[model samples]
Target chain A: MIAVLGLVVGVVAGLLVRPEVPAAVEPYLPIAVVAALDAVFGGLRAMLDGIFDDKVFVVSFLSNVVVAALIVFLGDKLGVGAQLSTGVVVVLGIRIFSNAAAIRRHVFRA
Target chain B: MSDHDRTNGHRFRAELPAEVTAPPSAAEETPGERTPAALTGRQRLVKGLWPPRVTRAQLIVALLLFGLGFGLAVQVASNSDGDSALRGARQEDLVRILDELDDRTQRLEDEKQGLEKQRGELENSSDQAEEARKQTVEKERQLGVLAGTVAAQGPGITMTVQDTKGRVEADMLLDAVQELRAAGAEAIQVNGVRVVAGTFLTDSGDTVSVDGNKINAPYRFKVIGKPQDLEPALNIPGGVVQTLEKELATVTVERSSKIVVDALRAAERPDYARSSSR
Candidate 1:
């Protein structure tokens, strides 16, 4: 219950603050967001499986964002940024879908 | 009984004999015996998912998700804001804007090509001074045509404004000249008076004066430019033709293969300014 409330509060604060993203980091933001979403879904799945670990969740979330941004940065340096970002989004999107499916089954049994 | 014992055997692994011998009610009351594997798969899944385990890890994950959602929302909002004007524009307006942009690009491309050609000629010619001199003369002739100091003939339009009611004013005639100039008029003449860069018009009683040279109706405008562009420019909706007609004046615009503006202005010597180029 407290966790859900924390999420709501974070979202409200973000919306109200509306911070300007730095231009240097703007290109990586979408990739980072996708990576974060994947981590979130993975965490939800782990919680449902009764294997939720605070340390594991925090580390995975941070690593996911960092690695995703790093890949895009490297791709940009290599001049394959667009293709690499597409690949990253596609892979993350698949994971999010599968995790969502698992959550749905846990909640609805259908 | 045997099947029940076999399925429930894993549930009572530590206290198998005690659980077998104990009362069923007492066995059911113990929380430790409710192992997930002991229940059916569906029931186990439900049990694992339900009664909301709000762990610290889950709270952190939620916070991260909140950040992700906020970023997504802002990105979406900003992207929409950038194209909102284009999105709201009508199809025709959008097409017209695109056409205008294309026309501008084409004009720029033509200018670039022309400049490149000039540079190529200057570079490839033997005796570069003679080539430069020739180009200078050609440029001077073009400038002279524009300055109305030399006569010009071209495929252009002839506009005759007959103002029987004399409602046509100097400003209206000035508007026509401006419209023609905007339509790429290279040279213009009204009643044998040359219209140049410094030409001005003023109301002189019942007639109009072009550079103080009084000209009466029908004001015949011999304009040297592309006939196609100049004619339509004058005849466009709410344009020069419509404005002139509203004044009870008769306006006739005719496209011709050749139009001549022979009216000349004297090349005046500069009193204060001279060419600064070496």
Candidate 2:
């Protein structure tokens, strides 16, 4: 319940603040968002499965965002930023889908 | 005795009924009551998953999800805002804008290629000084034509304004000159006076003066340029022709294979200006 509340608060704050993202960080935001989503879905699945661990979820979320941003930053330095970003998004998108499927099975029992 | 007793104890427990030995409440409360080895893979997975384990973990996960949702919404909002202008534009307008951009790019590319060709010629010429001198002479001739110091001939339109009522003013004639220039007239002559870059028209009594040279009606203009462009420019609705005709003047535009602008201006040397190039 607190977790859901925290999520709601975060969304409300973001909407209300509407802070301008720094230009340097702007390119990595979308990839970071995708990585965050992957972590969220994974956490939700773990929660449903009763194996939800706070330490594990926090670490995964942090590491996912950091690693995803790092990969994009590295790709930029290597002059393959666009291609690498696409790859990151694709991989994260697949993970999100599978996690969603698992959630669906847990909730709907179908 | 000890071995026999222990064997009998095991046999006694095995022989006992399941209901008496294992209670349902105990099984429900402590999942550890059954050995882990007795549980299948699926059963173990289910056992690990059920019964809402930790509150703190849920809170943290929710917080992370909240952040993700916020970022997603902001991204969506920004994208929509950026796209709204182009999204609302008419297809024809969009296509025209795109075409204009393409035309500008093509023009720039052509200019770049021309410059590159000039540089290549300068580099490849065996007699570089001679080549440069030749180019300078060619450039001077082109400048002379523009300055109205040399006569020019081209395929263009001849506009004759026969003003019987004398309603045409100097300013009206000036307007006509401006319109022709906009339509890409390379060289223009009013009567026998050359219309140079600094040519000015003023009312001198009943006649209009072109650069202090009085030209009386019928004022004949020998314009050197593309006939198709020059003719339409004069004949456009409410253009020079219609404006002149409204004032009781007969404006006739004749397209010719060749129109000669023979009136020339003396090349005046500038006393104050000098070539800044090395």
Best by DockQ: 2
Q: How do the residues B1-278 of candidate 2 rate in per-residue lDDT, one tens digit apiece?
A: 11111322332322233333335434554565665434332344466456545565655666677888788766656556774556433345577889999999999999999999998987788578888999999998899889988888889989999999988999999999999999999999999999988899999988899998889999999998888999999999999999998999999999999988899899988798898996
TM-score of each: 0.40, 0.39
Residue lDDT tens for model 1, A4-108: 565667666656776766667777887888887788777665554445556677777788899999998898788677788889999989978876766555445
lDDT per residue for candidate 1 within B1-278, as digits (tens), equals 11111322332322233223225424554675764433433344455446677766556666766677777665555445674556433345677899999999999999999999998987777568878899999998999998888889989989999999999999999999999999999999999999998899999899999898899999999998998899999999999999999999999989999988898999988798889996
lDDT of candidate 2 over A1-110, digit per residue (tens): 55666677877777777776666777788899889878878766655444545777788888899999999889878867768888999999997887777655555444
TM-score, model 1, chain B versus true chain B: 0.53
Q: Which candidate number maximizes TM-score? A: 1
Best model per lDDT: 2
lDDT of 1: 0.75
Chain B TM-score (each prediction, in order): 0.53, 0.53
